[model samples]
Target: MPELAEPIVIVSDVHLSARSNWASKLDRIRGLWQKAGTVVFNGDTLNLGLANRKEMCRQAIECIGQICQADGVRAVVLAGNADSILDGPRHLLLKGGRLLVLHGDVLFDSISPWRRSAKKLRAARDESLRKMPPRMRASIEGQQASVTEAIRIVHDRSGKRIRSRRRTFLENLVSLSWPRQILSILRAWRDAPGLAVNFMETYSPQANCLVMGHIHRSGIWHIGDRSVISTEGFEGPRKPGVAYVEGDSVTLRIARQTGASYQPGKVIGRVAL
Candidate 1:
């Protein structure tokens, strides 16, 4: 695969939609495009998982694409648990395969294990994997395929669950973050780094740095020889982290909102790939 442009900026879990503050976020991301040669939306750019929001998701994607075209910035959108319908690449290998970027949902068998539907999601994932040939199941592409299928299976039925309530987006978010769900989220955050390291060791042994965003925790951990980097989320409680990749190095920085745009803030971590 060819290399992305120099000074690539990667952000994930932006969750752009008509129901959220997507317009302002888009302005910030537009600023991001102006500062970098290429911008990668690591995953969950929009919540296509919600059947009711499919139209909104489509509009959000189109708007992003249009802006990218107008700005002349190369944009890459990877599929996430929420946006599994996207046909883009699920993972990227950078710096001669030493740096891996993915959405991070594939790190766990249950995907978003904190969700109320986690059991059903895991069952769907397991059934999909079981049907795959053993050789294919061992490959990264096959794993992504099964994950996409599982997401589809669960999310298709999720329409009924979501439509039963006519709550605002904030209310929906609050519902997902209830007390029990908070505990589950905390558990996932604690376990994610180790699972990420094991994932790279099993699938991409050449990669020493794994950059991902799903659990919405922006931090970096050094696990023996490997580094697990979570870029955080736009819709979460914490600020987001933007990963800048240039040459053989990757730097993690906090994103600070300045006026209508977001700029790279303090450097929290760095890794040599």
Candidate 2:
């Protein structure tokens, strides 16, 4: 047998549900394994809780676990919002030599529950937005501000992210502390030196690649001599791949998704992503 190359493949946000079409995607995932010595299953592998829906989430999780543990290699996973209680708190994921894997939520301590996503971000969430008095909303939009920033200010000022969506929309309209409150928030903060590497900041105190998952965007950055990298979510029709590189190689490549690579049975595309 040919010697398998040691590769670190980072993958995240595979919100696999029972209904999701994932089997076909797994075929391409095979491309990662023959070369991978380490696999990073970043998080959100499950859809989460509902009396009626928990089963689907469970199946998704089981399927993901199976995929991660395959190929007789070790895999690391992080927690994600959709997995909620199962999102396994900080420190669940660790890689060698200054590589840190975290879900990126527990960093701030208080997290808006996963259930709140729809009510908060939905396009028709106007009643929730109406209370903001227009100008502050403009600021958030202006800075391309993170929703975490908006919610943090409201959370700190009134001790709530907003007042039941109905009343929260306007509470900030009258608060004098809005500006200061937004300034003070510790957005995406981590107490651990290794875990602190962000796409924008240095990866580790010693400085190496910092790999994280949570927002589900694929990215790479230079951290001193280190590289901070992330692979986008595999769920929701994203163009996803598990990347592999070897022997301190400078070149990295992403394989194309099988489904979109070809139309009606041509040939699956393979391109850098």
Candidate 3:
């Protein structure tokens, strides 16, 4: 693939669904696109896997396409756990292989350990890997395929839940923050950076910086020679973040609210290639 444009901005887990604030923030999102020569929605731009939300996802994608049509702007979408069915690449190597950008779900066997279907998804992933050719099993393609399979299983298991148009506070709280789920979330957070380093060591050893979003906790962690940067989810307890990629440097910034929309705010971390 060609080199990404300079001043590339990445945001993930926008989760543009029926209940999201996207409708009012469309202009703000467009403003973001206009600021950077290239804008990458790193993952979970929408829940395209749901049968009930297909039209909503389609509209969101169309809006994105329209924005990208403007002069000097480019948009790239990398598939996440929620939208793996979309035809988007799961990962990208940038800055001549010194920086890697992906949705980050492929780094775990369960894809999303905090989800209620964690064990089933983990088992599905293992089964998927076992079915692959032995040599390809360790490749990036293999990992991505397994993650996609796990997401497919999640869709199958949550079809009814997804189809429901309304959600109460208790329902949402239980699904997002039950005791078991909280423990799983903490474990995943603790393990993500190391997993990122191990993944680079296996496939792209030269890449010293990894940029991803999933698990929702955004921050930078330096482990040995590699730096793992996660751009937090759009809707979360902690503030969301965006990462800017420029010549030989990557900077992480919080998504600060400006009137009705969010834009890159304070710099949290910077990595030089």
Candidate 1 residue lDDT tens string, 44-109: 887764313666666777777777777777788898988888877999988878899999999999
Q: By TM-score, is 1 or 2 better? A: 1
The true-versus-predicted C-alpha distance at residue 51 of model 2, in Å, is 11
lDDT of 3: 0.82
Q: Write the per-residue lDDT of candidate 2 for residues 142-215, one digit (tens) a residue.
A: 11123333333433444343444655546646545545443333322222223334321422344255455564
Per-residue lDDT over 1-273 for candidate 3, one digit per residue giving the tens place of the 0 to 100 score: 787777998888877766655645455655555568888889888765441366767677777767676646787888898888777698888988899999988888888888877778889899989999987788888889888987787677777677876788897776665888889889999999999999999977889999999979889999997999999876677888888998888999988877767767899999887
Backbone clashes under 3 angstroms, per model: 0, 4, 0
Report every candidate's CA lDDT. 0.83, 0.44, 0.82
lDDT at position 242, candidate 2 = 42
RMSD of 3: 3.5
- Mark the regions of model 2 whose C-alpha exceeds 4 Å error after superposition: 1-5, 21-28, 49-56, 67-70, 87-96, 106-204, 223-226, 235-238, 241-252, 259-273
The order by descending lDDT is 1, 3, 2
Q: Estimate each model's TM-score.
A: 0.89, 0.50, 0.88
Q: Which scores higher on TM-score, 2 or 3?
A: 3
Model 1, which residues run further than 4 Å from truth? 20-23, 49-58, 160-177
Error of 3 at 254 (Å): 1.4
